[model samples]
Target: MFNGLSVTEHREGDDLLTAGLGLGGLQSMAPPAFADATAPTAPELRRRAIWSNWRGIADLSPGGGYGSVYGSVANVPGREFSALARLEGARYPHRVLVQVPDAFDHDRRCVVVAPASGSRGVHGAIAVAGAWGLPRGCAVAYTDKGAGTDYFDLDAGQGVSLDGRTAAATAAELAFAPDAPTGSAGVRGVAVKHAHSGDNPEADWGRHVRQAAQFALQALDEAVPQAAPFTFDNTRVIAVGISNGGGAVLRAAELEGDWLDAVVAGEPSIHAGATSLYDYATQAALLMPCALLDASLGPLPQPPHAAQSVPQWTARCASLAAAGLVEGADTATRAASALAQLRATGWTDAALRAGALSVGFDLWRAVSVTYASAYGRYGVGAHPCGFGFAALDPRMAPRAATPAERAAWWSDGSGIPPGAGVGIVDPLMAGPDAIPTDPTFPGLVCLRDLAKGNGGDALRVRAGIEELRAAPPREGLPVVVVHGRDDGLIPLALSSAPYVAMARQAGRDVRFWQVGPAQHFDAFLALPDYGARYVPLLPYVHAALDRVEAYLDGTGTLPANAVIEATPRANGQALEAANLALPR
Candidate 1:
């Protein structure tokens, strides 16, 4: 569907499964069974095998715009075929569809996957889905989150039931197109966004988690309406998301385990529970009291020597307090006094933090403490704000400046200095040179936008894992989790912890795999797309699909090889092996 490129489509009957959809008959190629009960079942492993044959659809045209973005499923040549077949009530099928871009055409019955960001919405995702080599008709379609129309269109095309409670799928079917209306698509589902609410996202963690779940559920409603009804197998779903989508899935699992079966969340985050605006203010107050001392005045040391360095400067402040250069029982009191002075002029933390005064305050130090504290509460006590910033390791945390790093903070020195004292930062505070206006800085903003919109809240969502773990598994259904180590958006380390813990608690029988470093869902991030870092996962997806087919047919065993070595120290060992002594 790429505007400048073209994708070949094919249409055929369901008899193509005999040749194994171009990769050799995997239906008869069974692998050894895994001994570990905590591992994936045979059907799960097989699903991954069948999923690999889908080579993905690519749009290579130039000058294509958003209008070129295509959001439908199609077939591939020399591989598989696709068509809509309505299912009888309560009857599910194991059929699937696949595509090998280099070896097939769109009309071949296999789903044509293409990049959605490039006039190719979910086309690439569909290819990734097909690569699993599901069956002749079973195909994954791409749709817009806002529209929630995938299943609607699919129902019209195939006369399939819209009921989410039923787990029965017919023999299977697939469709493909570019720029399909957000309305109904034949036999295809859609994914929507979920969000939690209540407390301010900046201050309350629970509120954020709920918000994210809402957004994810919205996506699921649109993307996978097949599971809308209440049934055991109806919840056997899989998710592959990036950025906000990544964070949304995590929250969704908490809210609706009924449909969310497996997840590959890249750069996932939850809302922050501990790190809020007040916390930031408290840190600034404790570390850089001078900034709050006088809104009208410059830094206490005048142009606080940037060369003085963060550690040295904070050390100087601490040392000064020790020598009585400043007066107050503790850093907080001293900060409070300074804040009182600033408040007299109605100055807010946002104003000072972005002002020339912030240039003197060491931001790195404050930020490190913030990052460490937030993760610590969740049992991860390491300080990983990145070289000197926060949330660089992914897991949804945003990169932020620490007090030590704030030595470089500067203002354009143009606007009126914000008032003397205020609890939070005013998103609009900046000196004349603050950002030189332009398309970036707005005249007035909220504290949430300045600290890098929703990222902190996203990371905070991890805190909800504890709550999720405490809940009983919905109808004893197993959860499948997949992750790409090379994902820059969601660090492997961040997502690995909770997954391992969840698996450990569930006693295995669940499917958990780590493919090469993949970009959320694409094969490119994974090397060789297999076992190495950044390897493509299409093959594994095929294997997983094979397993799913077996589950539907009652003739499969989970493969040991299905577990692509994720993190070395899986289970609770990593938490126990952590350097910090946890509170029992």
Candidate 2:
């Protein structure tokens, strides 16, 4: 089932949870250094990736409980087994890693299946699952769910090894080696698996999770022959995750029940009801800049640079008016019209206000563009909108990635380009940035048009969107879900609330907890206004896992489904346990 599998042990301060950075290193904004910057070893890449992914996914603020509350980056001695595991006939390999801690109990065998959040690398869940499971002596199984950070630079003839090594494009069985064009310009751009693999990988997230769990049991048995016969019957297998990882475990539960005992999903980016991310994200990409201008929203959180973008947003409003997407005689009226459109499209009042964070960070454009390719199954450089990814020169034009950039692709990339220095290429938007007239506008229009399902790209994207909604988990699987009420990315109304209702109606055991004043990005909580206005959801994620485990262990009953009404740590005040209002 596995190819080129290898095992190695790590101990003595170089641990599983923090990769030897300890709490201090993770807190630092700068990345860990490779002794050889141009060519990082597989282990070095792994450590830096862990640090990058942990900071990307979780809030590590001193006030938000880095050292005091739950984060303990102490040395966790363990053996790690990793390899390129593939689905039947799959063109791309999904990477899975199983970490077996030395403290794992032969009798109290447990395995935690944690798929990566979003399109992150296999370490994406290091913050949520690794931090929680490694200390409890549970062997943690992690998969990128077929979408990983194995990037390809067609211009440089370079791609990445599954072990995080830089390799030639022709190397066999690299995680994602796309078909390079004969003429360099034919494919002279960066390629990302999630957007360019033509796999529509989201369709197989459940199977990927199942594969990780299977590998976990096998690896655990091999790591400790004394526990050579571990199986689901004897060992407790729980699935825990957040964001896309959260959606994956829920999908796994639906695909199979017996192997998965219980599920704890936090702010899952699921499609259960009337809305899908592509539908809303594309809309937000077009409308949010103008929508944020609504006077009712007042002075919400925004970076200092957001003020500079006001001219771009004003230009966006004028362009929308010209295109008839909104109606107005002036910017303020057009902004109000944009706000109404958001409400009409199912965005709630809370989400509208909280969306300022994503808007400020320019996430709406990044997400809409990435998912458009995934859902439409568009291959590298084939985006109907003429969107492409490449490393930018000082001139901001596309250029080949540097050797140092290639070395860190696996460690620093978010499994999507237009990041880690690979910016998006839009043919219609001139100067890329020097012109600076809302360069995202043209690409966003193309994505929004594709959402309408008239052309071939639109039809393909809609079909893929249909495949995203997995049925509620089968009866007998107990589920505990925790969602932040104000989540703008995957709003509660669009995702969790409807899924919970459907799951209960289907007779599946499910408990839902809604935490107010909590938004989607826990990592964003470390930001200035964000720290003041939002509480971290990771603590509640751990809490939900605890409830599900206690119920599974017969030590306690499942917490009743209820609203948490969590308090925000406003005005620079430090966060407290009371802020969570965790279900007891």
Candidate 3:
């Protein structure tokens, strides 16, 4: 048993004697540590015990956001900080950090912060805890959703290498077999592996996120008693997150709403398949051809699709154009000419005759232009597929020029196809060798379906507000959703707007606020001397948190749902006012 060991024994700088104890060993040691320690109270002992367990597994030094503006609140006076504590997650142990201000209101109010997707785990949540939690005198807990370096191998299986002739042959075959199952003929599963074994098959990404939130809340409950000098009010717990984290909080609310007082999401990545028409159109135009080629040729090739016969290629392009999804006369002309050439000769002959790869790049540009023009007309943002797709393709990682090349190549209209009234093509052609043309298209569609439980996995993870309205309601819990009107990464219309409407229609207490002139990652840009900065949205986030805290405290009225024109100030703060022109 873990006797005589106090939880507070391992302070901020203290080293543990039993650092080698793995998760299993640690679990075997001692009871709950709720018993009184020889040196101090039982709560203090429990805190130290938990800290030791956490530090033994992961680094808790304030390195991630410590030097950045987001961690600036660490300098605030009268704030007590705790080293990250390891908590039991759904499948494995995860990390959590707690912060309590000296002037804590003793109201038992706590805030749980989640990070954005692709973030370096708990590091992503540190700033929010500092900026939004400390100043408000609320206890804060930050948790990583198993995306940290310790939980996932960043470098493992992240490359596409075809060395042997057999492997190369399999790659070539897979390239053409669109319906081929993932993990077949060396196809890699894009889903990153968890740190621990025995993963629950039923737990999709959303379920994992919900479980992480639950663990954090449980850790806070245990840590509060030990943090006696700085009391924490845990009764009013609010979950807040941005981007992927935003979606997580929504799911957490849906799964554990009874325990939460409020939920706040900013530019949440939700409703996966709910992309705009323009997004689907552009993605189809760019990826369909690449997918076709990639399937025919391995990751690297001298000439691809030379032997393959793609008789339906032209027909597909024609279909899109006919559907009015493709715009611009120049683009239409190019599509037509490309189709005509395909009909005259097979994909191989046409490719060799016209430099197929370059032609594909040209088609990408033309289609992208049409998509962009349509985006502006429709007032929707471009799908964030460029980044998402790059992450999926390991080749893009080694080739630094790949991402820039993709952006520039698609934007510049150099390789337009010449012809008249070209017919459109269907990106998702169905059956064998079907082209996946959507931004949300999973390369290993079959694998995704198997892992996610169905084709609606992405939507399920997003936990869209509209979808939530149809679920069993969590009575009395209010939700405040904030979005940046200028966020091209996750457009407001496709994400938060629909949820707000759904909640209102369901008679749920939901408020939506759109912040203009602010884009995703605005808060990160707030850091002084941060290179390549954009408009900072930290001011708006802070304001939103303030409003949420007020609502929780029953001391202020919720602002009417509307758009706020946010103007960035010279001092890095944003000036926000109600925009009457925007529809509520």
On lDDT, the candidate that comes out on top is 2
Q: Rate the local accuracy (lDDT) of all candidates.
A: 0.29, 0.84, 0.38
lDDT of 3 at 65: 21
**Clashes per model (N, Cα, C within 3 A):** 173, 0, 26
Candidate 2, which segments miss by more than 4 Å at Cα?
A: 182-184, 304-306, 431-436
Candidate 2 per-residue C-alpha lDDT over 421-492 given as tens digits, one digit per residue, 9 for 90 to 100: 778777767734323666667778888998875998899899999998969796788888888888988888
Error of 3 at 436 (Å): 20
Better of 1 and 2 by TM-score: 2
Best by TM-score: 2
TM-score of each: 0.33, 0.97, 0.49
404-496, model 3: which lDDT tens digit per residue? 222121111111111111111112233354444432222223222222233443343223222322221255666777787755445566567
Question: Across residues 212-276, which tens digit of lDDT does each residue of candidate 1 receive?
Answer: 22232333333334444323233234444333333433444444434444444333333323232
* CA lDDT, candidate 1, residue 206: 18
After superposing candidate 3 on the true structure, give the runs of residues whose Cα lies further than 4 Å from its correct spot.
Answer: 1-72, 76-109, 115-120, 146-191, 194-234, 272-473, 523-535, 568-584
lDDT of 1: 0.29
Report per-prediction Cα RMSD to one decimal. 20.4, 1.9, 17.2
Where does the lowest 10-residue lDDT sum fall in candidate 3? 158-167
Q: Model 1, which residues run further than 4 Å from truth? A: 1-124, 130-135, 139-143, 147-475, 506-509, 516-533, 559-584
